[model samples]
Target: MVIGIAVIVLVLLGLTFCVIPVVAHRFGEAAERAAETEAIAQGARGGVLAEHRVRFKESAAEMAIPFGIAAVLFALAACDAAGVGAARVLTWIVAAVLLVIGGFVTSGQLRAAQWTAAAFRRSSDPVVRGLDTEAIVSAAAREFPAWLRPLQVVRFLLTTVGLLVVIVALITPSAAAHFR
Candidate 1:
């Protein structure tokens, strides 16, 4: 039962700390790349665009640490769930990895707003210069990734439901016993 509780907690932690950041980062990268490509195709080429792309890539890589930690936790949880070989040592190793590389990534495509604003500020193009910097940044953030919309909904639902389950299992005597 203790193992059951541990698994639940691990899953919760993994989802909260690891999976969400990586997934969100990935979604953001795709959007940035698409935006970059579209801009290029539209004959928009300049130092600003170049810098924006560079920042976009850097931001994407920053989330790797959390993703790695989440992966390890999830794997340990799976091993625990399976009732297989013990992962006592493995858990420590994963923890170390998480500690070493647990750096955070950008929150979402919203980070792209900064890059976009920077690009606009640096651009020589009069049209780009004329655009409101704040508006562009705000618009960039507002343009939510269409593909991630459904996934976002699902993630929210699962997180809420999982939290409820964890709460109930921890509080109710009978339910708590099951996870003992």
Candidate 2:
């Protein structure tokens, strides 16, 4: 039962932290690029450029659902309501892996957003210049809640702790039994 629950949680974490964001970011990038292309083609200004910015913002907002789900799962795990039992070590290992992957994904997204914003800033086009690049970039990069931002450091700490726990659980049979 514990293994089954851990598997389910792993699948959910993978989808929530990995698959969903990649898809959303790609689609959002496509939409933003398409809108920019159209605007440039039409020599348009203001409305379409604004929509392009909105697309970036929307893509960032798209993460809210996954974040919410993750938060709920986190709360459940914290409360020890996530089927903690014989598979505790497995659970911790899976969580550490997921956290590492999630960190990469999140940093990649932020870097992409910042790169895109930099490109816009460097553009000679009047339409691009008219839009507030700072606001757009902030919207894209500020996907996490303000309070949650500080916890970014905690992610690394937790990953280290999780890894240590897994190591201890592996090397010591008694510790492994305790984890179970």
Q: How far does residue 39 in candidate 1 sit from its true spot (Å)?
A: 11
Look at candidate 1 and give me any clashing residue pairs: 1-179, 1-180, 2-180
Residue runs of model 2 more than 4 Å from their true location after superposition: 1-44, 47-86, 109-115, 118-132, 138-148, 151-174
Show model 1 residue runs off by greater than 4 Å. 13-47, 52-72, 82-85, 106-137, 145-180
lDDT of 2 by residue, 67-167 (tens): 66466445435433333453454545555655576556555444554555555666677666455544544443345345333343343343344434433
lDDT value, residue 124 of candidate 2: 77
For each candidate, the alpha-carbon lDDT, in order, equals 0.51, 0.48
The residue pairs in collision within model 2 are none
RMSD of 1: 7.5
